[model samples]
Target: MAERSSTMKTPLNKALAQRRSKRRYSRRSCGEGTYLGYTSGRQTVLKIPTSRKKPKSRDITNQVDPDQVALLVKKEWHLSYVTPLYQFRYTMLKTYSKELSAFLVSEKQQGQTIETGQELCFKVNISVVLGLAETNQDAETIYIQILSKQVFAAKDEAQKVVWSGLLTCINGDVDYLRSLPPEFVSLPLLCTSGPESLSALVKSWLKKTFDCCFGPICITSTNLQWLAALWTGCHPTKNIQYLKLAWTIPTQPPMDVTYKVNPQDVWKLWDSARLDDGAEDSINIEEVNSFIRGLQTHFFRHFRLDLSAGSLMRVSTALGSAHHSGKIKITSPDYMTTVLQLLTECALLKMPI
Candidate 1:
């Protein structure tokens, strides 16, 4: 507005020009206070670290190594849906108390390399109650339970524990673990199953562990043969009786006790006989006794007061061939007249108790 100025640039315009020129220059070369008008044009002090970059993962397998974690399964336990055992160690971080998910990521990245059969070690808490699990003199069974439930119980424990496959483990192929003994080794299911079911495993483990924990059975088997896997930890007489009892036809139904029976074990001795189909199932004395009892009762009733010829005939037919089994021979009339004569004799005796 004032006509006295020859130069046309205003003070504001000069300041703006200086600012543009300053922006063109390297900020490092400019004086500390120089204004270039870029966002937050001044460097500020930071008390905390900011230059650290987020780490990148190096894992490619989504798997770790030290594999061999599928052999530790118990005979009685049910296993399903298993990842390899070694991966457990990679997945879990050991600690007293921490978030489960957080612990899973310890020092491990998505693509990091892990050993085969790496397992996550877990510390479990178990309080002993007598008569519940058994007297816990040392309280170590808890550790066994944890291993069984978490890592070894995984369908893959045979791979992780003793290095075995599903079929091998179930089919009695993994006997190396038996040498270790349950007490010393802390196997998952310590006292169950046969060779097919881990009974052999159970027996060997008992001998080893029981010897270590308690001591030798003061009474070792007089006959070493009695100590075999077929022995079943029972006396000879009782074993035979049990076999007989086992033979009873289960009032309910019969099942296969021979081996590889997946489930259900209730049956009378008679029922067990079906297993014998005269085949793989072992037959004992009790079952045969039951058969004899049924046969004798069904075919002949010699103690009756109302015996008749027909009844006598049946008795003779049943007993004539079977008499070899009895110490005493019965003298009854022949079939035609036996019933009538027996009635007269029974009337004379009058001993119908």
Candidate 2:
């Protein structure tokens, strides 16, 4: 009976060891579709599936449908890009041909900056019809097609006549210039013949076009007199912010005229207009002085101006009075300083003066 019991104990011990080993290496079914399986590693560890499904490519039709995307109708359009050598086409609609023509002329004239390609679109109250943009690799030319149909019905006859005259000028038909309303007779001068004519053209152009929404005007010509005049004249009435003159040294010196430096103009321009409604004096003494002081401080900090030159020195001297001893002994502004001050003042005042 003892020998039989020993034999059963040996077999029972072996069976229990086998069951324990199988339990140690068994696959564990985790929650959901995932399961942990023991792989080639000797240690009992969970192995996650590494398989990923390959993406399939589906064939789509090559044809493009215009209706599939939003249309560009009745949207305020501006010059997207204009290359120096590019040609422009105006596609007129059946109605409002004059209005469309005027808008086209405005766009073309506005794109006359020396910058090769400019994104200088301003508030002109014009809508785009078909802005056809075509790129030519071999010829290196960009053709801009402005399809100017009846984008918006004119509110009044004034709007119609204003635009029609502008279109006529763009068409190089100056015969309509005299017949146009007296206010817009100057519009025809925008068809610039050469550099000699640009000064007058720019002056007339600014007078006719510079309104509340004109953002920036970059003059590449070396004519500083006209630039200063245009800059001053436009900024007072309109909300023009940017005035950049592309200065190039002319081979021959320009007309021998003394360029005056009037820093008082800056102060006058910077100061906000008084309320005609008879509200209390909005121009606080401390506030106005503080604003001027800040602007002068910033200008001196960024740029080096000779404080000894001309009438500007008077203004510069007065600038110190607002804060410190009100007596800053400085010399006249040098040539470069004068130019810098002119350009800086214009650029700094991004808002209407």
Q: Pick the candidate with the highest lDDT.
A: 2
What C-alpha lDDT values do all the predictions have?
0.20, 0.22
Error of 2 at 284 (Å): 34
lDDT of 1 by residue, 127-180 (tens): 221111111221121112122123455654442221111211111102322333
Once fitted onto the true fold, the runs of candidate 2 whose alpha carbons sit more than 4 angstroms away are 1-145, 148-224, 234-243, 250-353
Model 2: how far residue 257 lies from native, Å: 20
Return the lDDT, model 2, position 49. Answer: 13
lDDT of 2 at 148: 23
TM-score of each model, in listed order: 0.17, 0.18
For candidate 2, lDDT tens digit of each residue in 1-353?
01000001111111111111122332222111221111111112211111112111111112212321122121111111111111222332222334433544565476643221222222223222121211111111111122222234353413211110111111111232233343222111111111222223333443443321222312111112222322322233332233221112222432111112233443233332211231231222222223333333333343332111211111112111000111111111111112222222222122121
Give the 10-residue window scoring lowest on summed lDDT in candidate 1: 42-51
